[model samples]
Target: MDNLSNYFGQNINQKRIVVTGGTTGIGKAIAKLLVSLGGRVFVFGRDENDLNGALEVIKAKSFSGEILGISADITQKDDIDLIWNKVDNAFGGIDILVNNAALPARGIIEGNYEDWKYILETNVLGYIAFAKEAVNRMKVQKSGHIINIGSMSAEVKEKTGVIYVSTKTAIRGFSTALRKEINPLGIKVSHIEPGAVTSDMQEDSKEVQKEKIVSMEMLEAEDIAMSVLFCLSQPKRCDVVSMQIRPHLQII
Candidate 1:
């Protein structure tokens, strides 16, 4: 895709952006692209090493906007509070929030109750809590955008992927209802559902993922990042509410 900030003649310079799960995969790509487009971004992640890695890359990039990394687990309320406190001190206020933190899950047939709880806490509860924070702040500001990263499994509903699929489906509903409730308040909410992306979240081994990538059976992280930028670049009068992006060859 073309340079997003310049593509539609949009001016996002200095825009304060908060991205969850931004130390890897699709979130990292979004952070990199946002910085390249001159948007000040604060990316949150649970791992210190990954946060440092992402920060290094962001700093290495030559762009007008800068990036910061925060070490915090999205599932923790204390961490969430600290994230916002840091954001307030660093950016004064937020203009955009991207809820992208999620964990992959597999079959419930084995009764992996622990894994299921963790996934729900991270994917479902985490998103809702963080979004509630952004909505409260955005409501006061009277203008803001919250973008939720969902998955195509929300609709596809694969048998073995019940836990992961259920969370994405919940996100779809949350996005739609939140948009209706907040649109009149001047806040925009959107959901981006992607199909078969090559990421660490995949259940397959790295070797298999590599094969899929080589065969062009999956979408790159940057592809989803561009779609995010596309939604952000739209005119104020337009809201690209729900977008489902997939590689052309992806069967789903």
Candidate 2:
């Protein structure tokens, strides 16, 4: 068999990946799935305890590949630098970056400047900073992928949580422009927008969330994780620019 066809899907085996806010919820789920598929994964969160716990669980289930964890705030430049330094030493170079760290926003009228500032820094600027770092290395390799976890709230534009909505809208625009700017470098950018996922960010209780999931009124964090894997597994010629995933029964 001397076939020389170049058409093939991206294999996750041995791929170096960085996942932010990976101590819990969707980020953790994504990290777990990636590691299971044989991708070397580095995950970080703001809480030391959470990071440790997530690493424990992820490592236990990982049949192949490697996993590491660190506790650091994504909005801090020093923290990001520290993470990247460790990544360089551990993985040599990155093949993928998942920007997922974020804080839930209060109502527009509820918080003052400091509150809004914190959310903006974590949700908006943090993504940009991480992307910049990833691009620095990815451009040199001339191939990589950046997956941004967004929310459907950007388009839903509900009356409440205007701050969160605004940040998501900015992410939508940023992802579009980022793709255009970096696509020429052979790096792929994908924005995944999810709706009504049951996570720590939600106000609903565990029982309520479970019921909602049963009723298809909400999605599970793992659902979004699967979407991420789908995007990454595509062939290089096929770039999944953006994806919107919602529960079948969820409306809003």
lDDT of 1 by residue, 1-252 (tens): 677536643535688899999999999999898888788899989889999999998888787788987899887789989998998899988888999999988667855777788789999998898888888888888999999999999999999888888899999999999899999999988899999887888877878877877788888899999899988888788999999998777886
- Residue 79 alpha-carbon offset, candidate 2, angstroms: 0.6
lDDT agreement with native, every candidate: 0.87, 0.91
Evaluate residue 154 in candidate 1 and report its C-alpha lDDT on the 0 to 100 scale: 95
- In the range 124-230, model 2's lDDT, one tens digit per residue, is 99999999999999999899999999999999987788999989989999999999999999999999999999899999999999999999999999999999998
Clashing pairs in 1: none
Candidate 1 stretches with Cα past 4 Å from truth are: 1-11, 205-207
Worst 10 residues of 1 by lDDT: 4-13
